[model samples]
Target: MILLDDVHKTFGSVHAVRGVTFEVPPGQIVGLLGPNGAGKTTTIRMSVGYFMPDRGRVVIDGHDTRESPEAARSRIGYMPEATPLYPEMRVADYLDFRGRLFAMDRSSRREATARVMDRCDLTQVAHRRIGVLSKGFRQRVGLAAALLHDPPVLVLDEPTNGLDPAQIREVRGLVKELAAKRTMLISSHILSEVERLCDRLIVVSGGRVRGDGTPERLAAAASQEREYVLEARFDTDESARGFEAAVASLSGVASCSSSEPLDGAWRRFRVSARADGADLRESLAAAARARDIPVRELHALTPSLERAFHALADAGEEANP
Candidate 1:
């Protein structure tokens, strides 16, 4: 439903987006993730027709953003990071005014306002002034405004920002419910939220897309090092030292570090190996048997989405620098 084809944007000396291209198919929820200075906001602005791309083009539902800015924008409902709302207006009044901007007739505006207020859980505060509403309610008002036009594409930038845990979950559930019928592109700094909400992720950094795939695929691809933890009880200090040395000397092991003795005689060790290394559990088991050490625990930690995000961002910075 949305496409950015080789899109590039620049401001004076700073290049904000470079050759950024992605497509969000119908009924899909895609997450846009990146570090602080990455071009996520720029890409979003261009995609929504808020900013014109210096090169390439943005297309919304087959309408060229440059040539048909109105048609393109009419297909999208955008809620920015800091939602702009009038504190003096009542929740229903604000939504009605937004519908007016879309040239919705009085009857249509009333219907849309009522529908969105219910959808966004703003019906209870319909008569309350926006200024007196809590942060969560104000956010719901912003979301209700965005939905007033019933656009097919929803571009939400940090939809859950600044909300408490409960509020975040509430908004998250609402977004999930909305995604069933429309295409969505959400930008968020929260990796866990993205993992839970999005069907796919587009990781951007240094003005370009560094990674794009399902969360599991990206995490696995970025895991270039494998880590394992082993706990064992040793007969003497010399035996523990010897075990550490033996594990570190193994052909595939990159590094191994041990923790202070837990309890009295049980020591924990963390081992790291290259991505291509054989499973270290077997090697460690063999080493423990050779030393007659009693193994307490041995396990490998799984790669996580946060690790993948950082690794991709690091790669982008290195490439750009």
Candidate 2:
């Protein structure tokens, strides 16, 4: 349960967030994605009560961030992109200290510290100095510190920033588990991770929301063409050129090009179709059969998250500029 209504933030002449509005309902994980200067951090800061929006409201669970910073913040567990930690302090001790900062009572602090350590897999390293731990371990410590208060909403920026593949997967699993009880807002540069973990995405660019929807919906809306890869055996270079020409001339086909021979006689080709065109594999295969060309592989490539993100961002640039 988080909401931003026409939120706007600025620093000097730079307007970081402009008329941004979105809502994260309970039990949902929404990914925030954008390039470097897209104002994601600024927006998150306002949502967590670290910064007050200049023009609109940022309400956490029901508390207005500006009017009730403490209440709003109490509902959120924020783990920034580069979480600061005390290298000299032991992990368990550090978490306990954080609990105290949250105004947790001694009994509550002790219980929360132990629960977070176990949940974050930090129990084994409970007494180890944070400074000597690996980056992944440190990340876990930061995450553990955030959970000490048991907030209902989590705002995590680059939560998997310093972890290995296994650790990343572990964090992914943990986030998924937490989503059952807490609303989550995640910002990550990793598209694959976002696609896997988030139920929806909000793409921002040039201080505004450029896209918002499920990954498939956004990708489909942004895609202007469908791409396919076709690999087949050719008798000679001339035959390959002829095949390319034939495929390129097919109805709805936008372009077709061949690459150098792969393996031995098999050559790969890329075919693109207009945005409104149906699948061309059947027609391409029929034409090949008419020409007696031996087809080894043919498949349509789905629109990827990276491609959709760029398309939406570029659209924003053009519209704003």
Candidate 3:
């Protein structure tokens, strides 16, 4: 539903984005992740037509943002990090003003305002002034305004920022519910939130696209090798050392280390191996049985998205520096 191809932007001598390219498929929720000063907001602005890319294209639903900015922007609903709101206006009034800006008729404005208020759970607070409402309620007002026009695409930057646990949960749930019908591009610092909500991720650093894929795919791409956890019991420390030696002797095994002391005679070990398309569990079990070692448990450990994000960011920094 959205595409950025070789987009580049600069301010004075500082290049904010450099040949960054990615796509958000229809009915998909994609997360735009990056460290501070990595041009995430700049890229988002260009996508929404708030700022024009110095080079390349930003397209939304087949309309080029540079060539048909109004039409392209009309398809998108943008809720910025610091939601701009009229402090003195009531929630309903604020939504009405937003509808008016979209040139919605009086009847259409009322209908859209009512629908978004209900969707965002702001009905009870509709009569309250935005400044008097809680931060969470104010955020809902901003979101309601963004949805007033019923855009097919949503661009949300830090949608849950500055909210309490309860409020954050509320907002997250609403975003998820909205994603059922609309394409969403979310940029958040909360990695776990992104991991939970996003179908795919676009990792950016130093104004460049560093990685793009599903979370698991990105993690696997960043990981140098596979890891496995092994637990077993031995009669003596010498036997434990022997078991480690046997496991390390396996062809694909790169290194092995004791992770934790289990019970009186049981111990846990973390085994790292080369990405040789080999299943070490079978070999590990066979080796344990040969040495008369009782295997308690064995399983592979999947690399985390957080680790993958940092790895990509670090790689970008090193390449640019």
Report lDDT (CA) for all predictions. Answer: 0.91, 0.92, 0.89
Write down the TM-score for model 3: 0.94
Full candidate order by lDDT, most accurate first: 2, 1, 3
Candidate 1: pairs in clash: none
Regions more than 4 Å wrong, model 1: none
Superposed by TM-score, candidate 1 places the C-alpha of residue 251 at a distance from the truth, in angstroms, of 3.4
Candidate 2 segments exceeding 4 Å error = 319-321
Name the best candidate (by lDDT): 2
lDDT of 3 by residue, 153-235 (tens): 99999888878988888888888888888889999999999988899999999999999999989998998788999899988
C-alpha lDDT (0 to 100) for residue 179 of candidate 2 = 94
Q: Please give, for residues 1-321, the per-residue lDDT of candidate 1 as tens digits.
A: 999999999999999898999999878999999998789999999989999999999999889999999999988999988787899998888888888888899999999988998888888999999999998888888888877898999999999887889989988998888899898999999999999999999999999999999999999889989899999997788888889999999888999988889998999999999778888889888988887889989998788999999999998889786
Worst 10 residues of 1 by lDDT: 138-147
lDDT of 2 by residue, 58-133 (tens): 9999999888889899889989888888899998889888888889999999999989989999888999999999
Give candidate 2's error at residue 185 in angstroms. 0.3
Candidate number that wins on lDDT, 1 or 2: 2
CA RMSD of all predictions: 1.7, 1.4, 1.7
TM-score of each: 0.94, 0.96, 0.94
